[model samples]
Every structure is written in structure tokens, then in C-alpha cells.
Target: MSGDVRLEARGAAEETFVDTVHDLLDVLFERGSVGDDDQMLFRLAVSEVATNIVEHAQSREPIEIDFALTCDAEQLCAVFTDNADPALIDLENVGMPDADAESGRGLAIALAALDELTRRTEDGNTWILRRRRQPAA
Candidate 1:
């Protein structure tokens, strides 16, 4: 893995989420591995996963987020893992909200922002997000 960065935190979901994203972006920026568009997408995806952990994963023991970034032969990839229950989400049936709805849009936004998305349940839910970087011209 090329460009790997990992972060771990435990606290109120919102603060931890924000800190995690900021740290991830800081690493990307330091490596000059991301562009404006990539940064925006990362923000969107990170928010989506973090919100899911806060809202769906009911845990009083503080949420744990493990975030990693890496590069393979094909793309730059991000992986986020949490120990919260995976059963809270119905991935196949992500119901849409009304047009006037103010929330429930995060999953859709995350799906659209990433080039590849996958979820798996082992110990908990692991969200894998992949974005193919443009080849240098």
C-alpha cells in the first residue's frame, strides 16, 4: 500500500468524525495525493459513514473509527471500519426520502461520490470506498 494513513479516536460521534476526516485530509494534502475534487468526495463519503455510525450504531462505549488510505495498481482507496452493529443498515433497500426531506440523503450522496463502494460484516461493518485517480497527463 502506498499512501497509507490511519486514525483512531473515541468520543462523541460528531467530534470524532470531524477530527478523523480532518486528519485524513491532512495526510492526503501532505502527500499531494488529492485534488480539489478528490477532497470534496472524501468529505462527503466520510460524513456519510460517520453519520451512520452516530445515528444507527447505538453504542455507549464511544464509537471507534478506523480509517485507512492506500493506493493499489488501479486506484486510491479508503477503508473505514467501526465496531458497531452491522445489522442496523439495510444496504439493499436504502429507502429514499421525500423531496422536501432534510435528512436521510447521506447514503445516496456517499454512493454517488465514490467510484466503488462495498460493505462487509465480520466483527462489525467495514465500509470500503475507492476513487480512481486520474492518470497524470
Candidate 2:
């Protein structure tokens, strides 16, 4: 594990998925030196993404979701993969939903909070969230 850490987990995309991933995150960050603001952003983005998968990822039975978290000197990165109906992912020109709206805002929140928020479809769906510790000079 040297100075870097990577964690991987897979479970049904149920209501408890967020908590499961977050517990791993808490341990990883505690061993490092992430600031409060960056930590908060990471937690918020991860929670939102996990919740979105639980609610929106098109599935009849509980689908399996894979997670990875990497922390190193340059940045902190998160990757999530799910065997969801890939057609439901829409990452183009996303906009925040109204305050009264219930859906369509999770991606927006993640995008606004993280340095990089990207999604791709391969064997399934993948979302990557990265935050840099130092600005480019």
C-alpha cells in the first residue's frame, strides 16, 4: 500500500450501498491528511452517486455495484461500476434540477463538487470522480 491506497468492493445496489462504500472511505482518508473541505466534497459526491445508482440504475432484482477508491500524493479518485441498463446514463449538458424537484440533480451536484466527474459505458456503467490536492502550476 506504500503511500497510496486502493479499495475495491462489490454488492447489490441497495439502500445500504452508500454506507458500505463510505465506511471504506472514512478509513482511507483517516490514514491520510485530507482537509475538511476536500473530505466533505468527496463524501458528498460519493454519497450522491451511490444513492443515484440505488434509485435510478435500471434493474429489477438488486444489481451488483463495484467500487474503487484510490488516494495518492497527487489526488484522490473514486470509480464505481454497475451492471445497470446502460441506456439510462445521460452525462451531456447536465443541469441542476429545481429545488422542488426530486430527481435529475445528483449528477449536477457531483460535477459541481468534484474536479472531474466523468462517466463511460463498457461492460457496464462507470463513473469516475477525482479531486486534485494541488492546482496546476
Candidate 3:
């Protein structure tokens, strides 16, 4: 996609965001903007991040969030901006938990599928995830 596909919501459930990501990726796929492998990886990372935000962000009221995705020949990117408490985890040190663990795998999974995953909290919490596209053979 030349521009970005955007969604803005307040206190949306994880499923909503995840579904939106899938739908957006479908559009990109139909447009020949990304390959199947890229779409699958980006969907996985976005779903994990959306679930993490909905489950972990502490807020007495509904959290407002802006989610956007973009794709080009070289890469795909997703950005999430939330009006919730700053996420306090170390993005650089996100590690997968033990296999038996039920939680704590979201960030790790996202990191593995992404070339760049970062979080900033200057004006609310902003998360950016990027994955480089593979060369077409």
C-alpha cells in the first residue's frame, strides 16, 4: 500500500484489532502489495501485540488507541498509539517464557517475526513493528 490503513477506537477488544489486521492484510494481498509469508508473519505479530495491550495495559477507563499499517515493496509496518499507562517492559530484553507458561510470550513472538519492534512513551505509549519483505524469486 502506498499510504496507510488506519483504525481508531476506544477500549476495543483484542479480537477487534486482530480481525482488523487480518482484513487489512487481505486487501494488501489482493493488491499484490505483499506475499503470503509476509502477511502471515505480520498478522501474527500484530495479533500478539494487540492482545498484550488489551490484557495488560492498566486503565480505569477505556483506552483510546490508533492503529495503522502500511506496506511497500521492501517492508511492512504497524504502529499502535494508546492513551493508557506506559508499558513498563523492556522491549530489548523480551524473552519467551517456559513452554509450560501460559503467558508472557506475546512480545517475544512479535519480536521474532519482526525486524524492528520498539516502544516509546513520550506522549502516551506508541509501539512500532516492522518486518522486511523477502526478495521475490
Candidate 4:
């Protein structure tokens, strides 16, 4: 709950809900002083995580979504949690989905955009994303 910026929402896991999640990231990047390039990459990585939850969570009731984005001297870190079913997604083994596949690419995109990306089953499902910050010009 405590971070440089924290965004929390409780709602149904539907595709239409992802834009609201993106708006949360926009707030974090703006207030937390993230630059344009870093903001773009962070947005993509976080969006993928949220999209995966919406499409796969299969929650009958509203699911809780939590996001924490922090910036330090070295890296930007994000932690996202959703009250969804425990899903075993192996980042190492999950290859790029086919070009024509509509789904199955979220994890891959997150993995590519993040310096460190990991998923675990905690109080539901949690995804941690970290990216090293480039030295200032």
C-alpha cells in the first residue's frame, strides 16, 4: 500500500478495464518523475500484466488489482497483484506466440520489456517487474 505511487482497484476482469489500469501507470510515471522512454517501456510491461489477468483470471466476482511503482537511484520497480486463480506461467518456457495469435503474447511482451520479470502465487497472483534506469545525460 505504501510506495512512491500506489494504485488499487477492485473490479471485474474484463478487456475494457485495462485502460483504467493504464491510467494508473500514467499517474505513477508523472508523479514519480519517469522520463518519456522509461514511461513507454514501463507502460507496456505493466499493461501486459494487467491484460493477462483480465483475459485469464476467470473471476466470477470483482477482482482486486494492486500496483506499486517505485523509483530509486538504480532501478524502477513495479509490483502488481490480482485476486485471480493460481496460474503457472513459466516465463522461461513460454515462447513468443504466433504472429496471428490474438492472445498468449502478454507474458512474452512483459518479459522482453523488463530487466527482471517474475510471477508467483501469493495472496492470489503477483507479478514483479524491474528495469534498470539509464544514467542521466
What is the lDDT of every predicted structure here?
Answer: 0.68, 0.83, 0.78, 0.75
Candidate 1: TM-score?
0.75
Candidate 1, residues 10-39, lDDT tens digits: the string is: 445555575666676676645655566776
Candidate 4 clash figure, as a count: 0
Best by TM-score: 2
Q: Please write out the lDDT profile of model 2 over residues 1-137, one tens digit for every residue.
A: 24987888889988888889899889878865677777888888888988888878885655899999988877889999998877365667888988999778888888888899888888678989998765333
TM-score of 3: 0.86
Q: Report lDDT (Cα) of residue 74, candidate 3.
A: 77
Among residues 3 or more apart in sequence or in different chains, the pairs in candidate 3 whose N, CA or C atoms overlap within 3 Å are none
lDDT comparing candidate 4 with the true structure: 0.75
Clash pairs for candidate 1: none
Q: Each candidate's root-mean-square deviation in Å? A: 3.1, 2.7, 2.5, 3.3
Q: In candidate 2, how many clashes are counted?
A: 0
- Name model 4 segments beyond 4 Å from true: 1-11, 59-61
Candidate number that wins on lDDT, 3 or 4: 3
Query: For residues 15-106, could you state the per-residue lDDT of candidate 3 as single tens digits?
Result: 57666766766765666466778878888998889878877877666777777777767778888888788889898788999999988898
Greater-lDDT candidate between 2 and 4: 2
Give the higher-TM-score candidate: 1 or 2.
2
Candidate 4 backbone collisions, by pair: none
Query: Candidate 1's error at 72, in angstroms?
Result: 5.7
